[model samples]
Target: MIDTLWLIGIGTGSPAHVTMEGMQAIREASVILVPHKGAGKDDLASLRHGIIAAAGSTARIVPFDYPIRDPALPYLERVERWHDEIAARWQTALADVGVSGPVALLVWGDPSLYDSTIRIARRLTPQPTLRVVPGITAVQALTAAHGIPLNDVNGPIQITTGRRLRDHGWPIGATRLVVMLDGEASFQHLDEPDLLIWWGAYLGMPEQVLDHGPLADVATRIVAARQAARAQHGWIMDTYLLGRPQDAH
Candidate 1:
């Protein structure tokens, strides 16, 4: 039985994103839970395996098929139900392993971001001591890969999802928004012509694609490219930053 649940951020499918502290935690863990998202997303699991392999840890790996969320229901309700299923899955995975030592899970990107693994961990009947090892986030990965700053100096950045951006207008207060998990290029809906966008798909991977320009000019291309990439690969992970240049207005 694991006495400690260590949620280690492995970054966005890259071993290089693992910090030394994360590596140390993996080495100390007796068992690791790796979630497989079926055939299309096997690489996601493979990346987690690679991180453990690189860390030189002999901890036993327990692989589980992630339960897909029901999209028919309201979004928040669906996520809540999905989280319940995932927590059940986690309990089942840890059942036979014995919880005497540390248990680790490699979360994509940082756990504090959009990940629900931390929330799931809290649902355990006998909650274990939790430790978080921060890794590169999609925001950081995209900005660094493109050599762009996340926000203007002395300015705040709002991090939101594609769904929210599409349903709600641009968020109030912050001019810069980092959008993630957008299935469609929702920026095309923005009526403002002055808005500029820096978009990236499969960032940090060899298949990475980047586009930047006035939203009106590149919106069509971005949507087309996103569709093509999704069809080519079984799955896709993308993020974008929207902002107006400081000198523009």
Candidate 2:
């Protein structure tokens, strides 16, 4: 049985984003689990390794193949099945490591955000003592990259997935919106004439890109840039903020 499980958030795509507490957890853990997302995604695994290296940690590093979700199934059902498979993979990795001391998993961005590491950890048999060291989130990175605030003065901001934005237009009562996990620039589907956008991709990385302007004017540019970035890098992580002008607040 595991003794302690540390969920360390490494922030979004930057080794420098790792907090001191997160580094300490990495140094102290007997085993560190890194998930490999297969070909063309080696940068993700390398980033985790780089974090460990920068921390000067000698902890045993274990790499395991990540499970791919079936695309045929409905979204929710596929995600549920995928999480189950991932948990099982984690268990197997732990067994292979044969460690009884504290174990750590390097998570991308803050676990409390749109991440599932915490939920998957709960499914483990004889769950270990859990510890979460929060790190910077994509929302924070995106805003920081563009040098803007997340919300207008005293206005409520809605954080949502691209699917939601695509399925339903902006929700009522949300004057500002931050969209994440959107492969499709759902902002193109919005009909809000006054809306402006601040978008960023690969934040904190050397290949970072940022854009902002009237939605109608810059939406096409953002989509073209996103497509080009994805083609160039084979993968991309991006987030965007949408809202009316600051004077409207």
Candidate 3:
């Protein structure tokens, strides 16, 4: 039986991005669960390991293979099924460790963002007390890396996924938008001539890449850079902002 479950956000790829509270949670937990996303994505697992080591935590590190979502299914359905499987895996991992002490899982970014760990954790049987340690979000990391502000003065910003941006176009009422979980560079789908984009890949890491300009002028370069980065690293985590400058008004 689990006593407490800590969902600690470790921030984007950089170990230094981990917040003090997150590190303390890592050091205090009796067992820390880390997900292995297979060969091409081992860097993620390695990053988690490095964080644990850097914290000087002696907690037992449990590694479990992450479930792959079936692309054949629709997006929502596929993600729902994948989360069920992941919750089951978490339960099994906990059973294997056979620990009743506080358990922790390191999340890539703030759990409240697009991440689903909180949703999956809710599915666990005999629910344990949940504690969340907030960490740096990709939007923050991306903006900071580019040395820019997230939104124009006195304007609202919409945050959404690549799929939504592709399927629904930009939402109304918000001039500024930040897109995440976009593997297809959804910005290309928009024909907004005045749109400006600030894109970053591998933010906060050694191989970080950033580009900004009118969408029409730089979209091709962004796509090529994204493709080359994925080819070189086998995977990529990226986020971007697309909107017109305040002066355009």
Tens-digit lDDT string for candidate 3 (1-249) = 567899999888899999888888898999999999987998889889999999999999888999989999987899999999999998887775778578999999899999999999998888889999999999999989978878777778899999899989878776889999999999998976688899999888888899998999999999999999999999999999988866233
lDDT of 1 by residue, 1-249 (tens): 457889999887668888999999999998999998887888788778888999999899998879999989998899999998988888888788766678899988999998888999888878789998898898998888778888787778899998998999798776799999888778888875488888888877777888887887888998888888888888889999899867123
How well is each residue in 1-249 modelled by candidate 2, as lDDT tens digits?
Answer: 567889999898888899999998888888898999988788989888999989888889888889999999999999999999988998887785678688889999899999999999898888779999999999999888877778777667889999999998889877889999999899998997788898998888888899998999999999999999999988999999998886233
lDDT of 1 at 150: 84
Put the candidates in lDDT order, highest first.
Answer: 3, 2, 1
Error of 2 at 117 (Å): 0.5
Model 1 is weakest, by summed lDDT over 10 consecutive residues, at 240-249
RMSD of each: 1.7, 1.3, 1.4
Please, what's the RMSD in Å of model 3?
1.4
Candidate scoring better on lDDT of 2 and 3 = 3
Per-residue lDDT of 166 in model 2: 95
> What TM-score fits each model?
0.95, 0.96, 0.96
Model 2 lowest lDDT segment of ten: 240-249
Model 3 Cα shift for residue 243 (angstroms):
1.3
